[model samples]
Target: MDQIKARTIEIFLPTGDSKEVSQAIITNESIKIIYISKSEIENQKKRISKIQGCYILVGKDDDGSDLAYIGQTEDFFQRLNLHKKEKEFWDGVYVIQNSSDSFDQAHLNFLEKLMIQEAKKVKNYKLENVKDGNNFSISESKENECYLYFSTIKTLLKTLGFDLFVPNVEEFEINEENKFYFKEKNNNFSGEAIFENDKLIVLKNSIVSNEENVKDNYIQYLKFRNKLINEGVIQKNNENLIFIKDYPFNSPSVAAGVISLKSKNGWEVWKNIEGESLDKKYRQK
Candidate 1:
């Protein structure tokens, strides 16, 4: 096929609705056409099947018939979404479920083996990082992602051992309570929050360098503090910035974040267990 050949695709959403869109197909008269939906490559469920899980998609590609793509999933829909988002090149794939199918743990293991077999038979992207969180890797990085299009994936598989456990775009859960000192990175970091005793703490800070001394508080932080104040977390002064109950407070960075959102001070934004900034807390100490 010509590299410049025009391509077309009909995208089906999770809702089962679809839209036809333009795409590309690297084709040459020498290479036969192979079509398989990534979703079809995983498990599906029926209304009556007591067992629930995904199945390995079994079908044929250009190489030959019965060349299956085996994969396991609790929610086929979730896995299907992953395939669609990561790869948008499956063509001529008729969207239909296999009739009368039920998936169980044994089925899952068998499906995995089948997928592994298929991986060995054909040049395909290895589902790397699946263990960490369903990460399927076809290439190395962003650079490799660009180079290893669907065609390149097959070629790479032919050259390298089949392994698809690539780290995917996902967030890991780090559960631990620690006091964090925030600095300006404009990076909205998210993690679990734990409330200990009377004070609230974040799980571990994932990014940035710190042992969790004190955090540069935001308005949200202040609001949380304010709630505590109403509930007696700290006592407030009649000043513009609230004060702790005579304990010294820690200030935010020199350039406070969310200045535009609301006028705040590095000094008053932060507080201690005693609810005082370093300025006043030191005196009390």
Candidate 2:
């Protein structure tokens, strides 16, 4: 996997923690990210309005899935003002700007398309903008620069606690020994999985119950299942809900709970091929 080397990031919390308004600047880069609340957009208007780059209006929908609208303009502040009056879904905006004022409309358009495509692939956010983001003709060198800039932007977003582009769990080079499984004899569910790097990934093609059958009223499990369905992480191939792609859950318990549709002790629920449970494995450690 390609990677970005770690570097120093200077942060400015203009309003401290009261308003959740902060800006991050990376050393030796032209990119500056301003994380601002919707209420304070006007307060920082003069500062951000002068920059030219792409901005993301980010928030969550009723179902609790992260949603965002990505757009770019030479006059960042004016475009943000327009969104403030017209859009209601976003609670915050992450403004990515070039300090040197080098990104023109064409460059920003290309960057916007790249960002949207990445957001769609990550499937971490429900994008409010239409998929028809315009693409512009650019030289190979310019394309390279824009993508490099995009990568840096992702790092900054993660630094600010927004990981929209987390690497898909399936993409990891997980070792075979680390694999585990959760099997239910029920007609609808059974699957293999692995927990890696704080993410529990139910492997691709794993079968999930189309119906919730857990003993407890684990509403969150049900909601998570629905969220996966909405995100295309879970799909119906015929009558059964199958995981079309490897899906990452926040924890092993959540992963096991969703598959079992109940309150599960993941330590006992997930086991290796030899039937050795995670509880025993962790105890041995």
Candidate 3:
């Protein structure tokens, strides 16, 4: 839960300026994680086809929800080639491997299971694999080793900007005194928010106004409303719309707009326990 320690990450850009087609390597670690876009994979087929390990297909669904599928194989790039033909969703992949080339089938199997479980728990991404992937067993020592490798892989993945795992609030900052609250005068809409870094997270079980009364002109907002319901972030029960889990919004206004079912200045709407508006807090800063 402590701050992420400073670590060295080496990225090899094959095409010089193409981030979508690069290999990210962390030295003195067990696994190699490569990121490549579908468009660039064909050119690097020979290079990737030679290596084998666990990989995750990363993409976004039509509802704008993140999606991922985790798998392990003896021939990594070959399987990806098949996915290119059969699966059409993923735009990129994070191919994980043992730098020492010591990871056997058991090691990759264990990593795949753990990865699937963690992805499901986060609920931030929609996993493509519906049923549980292979649930094979491994040796006790190998299990521990794979777990340590998995931790390393997570750190590397986060460093690359794909934060599939969400850490607890305490791990980032410790500002509990200035908890922000928002409420609407016309409806029974209310919510609590806390800051982590520059991003604000509206707490779970927060209440929002039902969209039935929202004007038909706000088509985008209505679509967003349906997306939230589909994602299980918002629940419509007893004629009320409520946040079932903590949701992060880019800014105070964005968060306020979602709950109010209309455009609102979040800085003016969110206030502290002492009734100090977010605008006032910003001026203080």
Error of 3 at 43 (Å): 1.2
| Per-model C-alpha RMSD | 19.4, 2.8, 2.6
Best by TM-score: 3
Q: Estimate each model's TM-score.
A: 0.21, 0.90, 0.91
The model with the greatest lDDT is 2
Model 3 per-residue lDDT at 136: 83
What residue runs in model 1 are displaced by over 4 Å at the alpha carbon?
A: 1-69, 92-101, 122-285
Give the CA lDDT, 0 to 100, for residue 246 in model 2. 78
Per residue, candidate 3 scores C-alpha lDDT tens digits across 1-285 of: 444665677888778754667677776666778888887788877768878799989998876688888898888778988999988889998888787899888887888888889877777778889766776878999999988888888877887778776643535443557689888567778888886666678877788877566676555566676688888888976878888777788788778877777777788888888888888876577
- Write one digit per residue (lDDT tens) for candidate 1, span 183-207: 3355332222222333223222222
Candidate 2 segments whose C-alpha is farther than 4 A from its true place: 1-6, 212-220
Residue 6 CA displacement from its true place in model 2, Å: 5.1
lDDT of model 1 at position 269? 41
The local lDDT score (0 to 100) that residue 178 gets in candidate 3 is 62
Sequence-dependent TM-score of model 1? 0.21
lDDT of 2 by residue, 172-256 (tens): 6766678888887645688788877766788888987778544457877888888889978889988788888777776788888
